[model samples]
Target: MIEGTDNVSREAAAEAAASSNAATILPGATIGILGGGQLGRMLANAGSAMGYRFVALDPTPDAPMGQVADQIVAAYNDRDAARELAARSDVITYEFENVDADVAAMLMSESYVPQGSELLYTTQHRLREKRAIEAAGVQVAPYSEISSVEELREAVERFGTPCVLKTATGGYDGKGQWVIRDSSESDEAFATLSKAGTQLVLEQFIDFAMEISVIAARSSKGEIKAFPPAENIHVENILHLSIVPARLEDSVLREAERLAIRLAEGLGVVGLIAVEMFVTRDGELYVNELAPRPHNSGHYTMEACRTSQFEQHVRAVCGLPLGDTALLSPVVMVNVLGQHVEPLLERLAVRDEAAERLNVAPKVHLYGKKDAVYKRKMGHVNVLAESTEAALDWINETKIWKV
Candidate 1:
């Protein structure tokens, strides 16, 4: 990973020097957001509530994030757009990590891109991300680099079968990656990312008992706060569900938190850092990967927490102290994916809200997306229960999402 932000540090420090309040962003200040997705929309909502305006930069003007922001700049990576956005905003932050560092750097050079663009340079590339995680004293799966057929063959021979070959950069939601179950799948895996050339890593298959993620935020001043760990389930490489307070041993839970703080401190990272980890059958924690922004796993925090991650994100980027990261209720979040437009309650047959139902479930959050395709993130429902089993039952009944 990129060790230090030599050039980007000056801008981050300057932006940190400009703001220090945590409760709210100053009125009328425009906060420039890099990506125009649901995360950006939530940030815009929180900013508006705080009397702050927002300018969103995205290639797709129709993206959900821009719908709520004050102004939309219809350019994703255009340096010219970055200059214009930087000129109008008091500070800038990104909702997505895929924002071009050069473009982000351009904005920072001119005005402010709080949190700096250094983290993105490392996270946008998987190889650097793995390196960073390991450097922070975390154990990653056994892996090797692959740039050619010879390299792939070597990696396969060295790491053995059932290894996953993934793009070293720009792969997400099951994209730009492959799981090689046997030697039979090697040729196809090579053909898939042939266009990407040398940007690939061969990872060892873990006999993992569970997958967990830590969504933590770090202010530009180096103060850090992390949300409770959440367990995740994936189907076809896309997130299927997430349950907070994942059924883990106390020692393991403490270890997860320790690893998270170590990683944030090691990177000197600013803003939200979501570290995905694998817990082996032997009760060992292994670093799976890292996402340097509000992660999909933390989406449940929107309703389950005292302060949503989006709000905390702004606080961190603005150099404010993070709010209390406590869980008010035992929440289990279920994803409403695929092509079903049924309101989640109706879909789950949960109707009457008159006399306060005793066995009532949790809250639901639906992204305002029009089209609903298979595996598409239409929305999600958060179920608060007296026990995990009760919540799981409700989730199973509500699983009639788009097939």
Candidate 2:
């Protein structure tokens, strides 16, 4: 819960609630963002172009978004700081779903937060998120809730070996999860994950042929638009590449989009929601996870689509009409991790010559992050080509990142 929220004056809360009823937030309104990460940075960039000002609240001084927007360096649950942000902005939104739900609810009551806290609460917990997906008439991997080692062992035995045990909350980027290939590993996996969170879930390991993601935006007026699916590849649990127009049967792509739209409407989202799915060898789709903001996989839309996800997010949260999500080109987005930053920089030094030599030009975007740690996402490159395979081949030929 946000500290000192009870101190808010009744008159102030009433006024904020009134302002939130405005049908649309026009340009020139100040937008407050909750997380000051790369997603917030990109959101600020898009909003700025549309004549909006930004204020960000984050714990990190000079965070990536703080580099561009006015930043209040404070903890997310700081009531005073949150009130300051609410007072200065016409609308508020968060960049990530891991934000404290209680704080988000406080902000919603004190500011115009189109994307409400309920979505955050549901998506932040894996068990709740999976249940929400199932409620939306979408298919998710079969899972069971576990509260103890005995429960986990029982669930694993019921589901069979080669299942996954994951904490219900506070896990991302391959963290807080263990794959139990054999029953022997259940005790260790349970002991390790229980330290992170008491609530756990065990899921059947899916033998997927490929992974894909669809980013959909929904406005307060109930307008929804979905972007093309992007086939994603991960290396060591970090996103490596996102290829647009996922090489799948047209029927499968349609089903993926249909599922995304259904989930978006069912979730009643007022902002962007990225739905990641697993495609089986038999062409079945299973919902893997959901992200309630701009996604890593949707980065390809920046260069390959008529409307970038960043701008679309601004449109969605600001109560404006959703933009056209038509694909403009076949594109591949490659993540530049910490290990590739130096090499990428060296190549960038000779970028013109490299483009000339490779006969492919890649648009590079680097987040102004201070450190270059292993597997940390430093930036991404979008390569638009005649085909997804051609763009992938260009990445391979450049050898900038080990494909």
Candidate 3:
């Protein structure tokens, strides 16, 4: 259950890009990366290491990804700049799934978009994603679309108590989603989104043991690799930690990987895909959702694995040989959210409570953004230990956050 290498037969790959011509995206080739966030920044860094030039597109100046790229295409004026990016780059890949699908639809006419835009289309909308997963023969949480209170009331009657109500679009990190304790709260749940004129997804609440994610990569040549399941914890809907080994039973872990690999191959997905999953109280697995790019759950690999997720993403998208996803160390990753991070540098400087308790090298990655607020993912720090328990303790007590 780890990232792929060149293992799958060529027949398993998409019909068109089966050849191994992907080895040299060539030094002079320019790679276009959509969305200039930290993930894009990391992808651009890996691209530069191979002598490839990069163009990062974003809507604002000083975007994290744009800082390191050869060409910075700011966000506004989507049509004009996208055509330009398609024209200049040999191939294009996106850092986030939220990019305008219409842009990809537009770009497909001119450039080679090996990562199918249809996957983007399906994943961008919650309804479409749930359908795709179900079509792949996977079980997803029971959900119904809601456009008004009347629809939501009917959904509550069908699905019943302890459900989550989420906006059908543009939501993450606990934003645009809420929990309705029972039928009594259905009215408020519906009113909340409906008053604001938002479409919604009312999903049955799951009584799961814990959350886990399998991060995998696939190349155009049908080669696939997967990273081990990462145990994930959330605080106020924001990701707090991702621990590897995931402390999962061998059987459950393998099943998670199987589901991920199946989804990747079934969707004809190219590049990295993170499949978020739920292990129910009965020891059964369920598909929760997906992210069509390198995920926060896989961040520990940068230092603990044989190959970084960023490198694998580039390889898969450009059709290069996949790298080994083997783990070199036990890792504990803590997300440093929002304003709490302003004091991180000072904490590390003091050798205070945080530094004194650590037993292994901790790799801290700051996204270089100055703003902070509750729930904003500003950066993450990873600590490696010999034992999973020890690793967890080190991460919990790191205190990289300021007062």
Considering every candidate listed, which one attains the maximal lDDT? Answer: 2
What order do candidates take by TM-score, descending? 2, 3, 1
Question: Please, what are the lDDT tens digits per residue for candidate 1 over residues 238-318?
Answer: 787788778999788888888888888778677888999999887899989888888888977877788888888888877
Q: RMSD per prediction, one decimal?
A: 4.2, 6.6, 4.4
Better of 1 and 3 by lDDT: 3
Candidate 2 TM-score, true structure as reference: 0.93
Over 105-198, each residue of candidate 2 has an lDDT whose tens digit, in order, gives 9988888898889889999899899999998789999999999889988999899989999999987889989989999998899889999845
lDDT of 3 by residue, 275-294 (tens): 99999977688898888899
Better of 2 and 3 by TM-score: 2
The candidate that wins on TM-score is: 2
Q: Which stretches of candidate 3 lie over 4 Å from their true place?
A: 1-24, 195-198, 350-358, 401-403
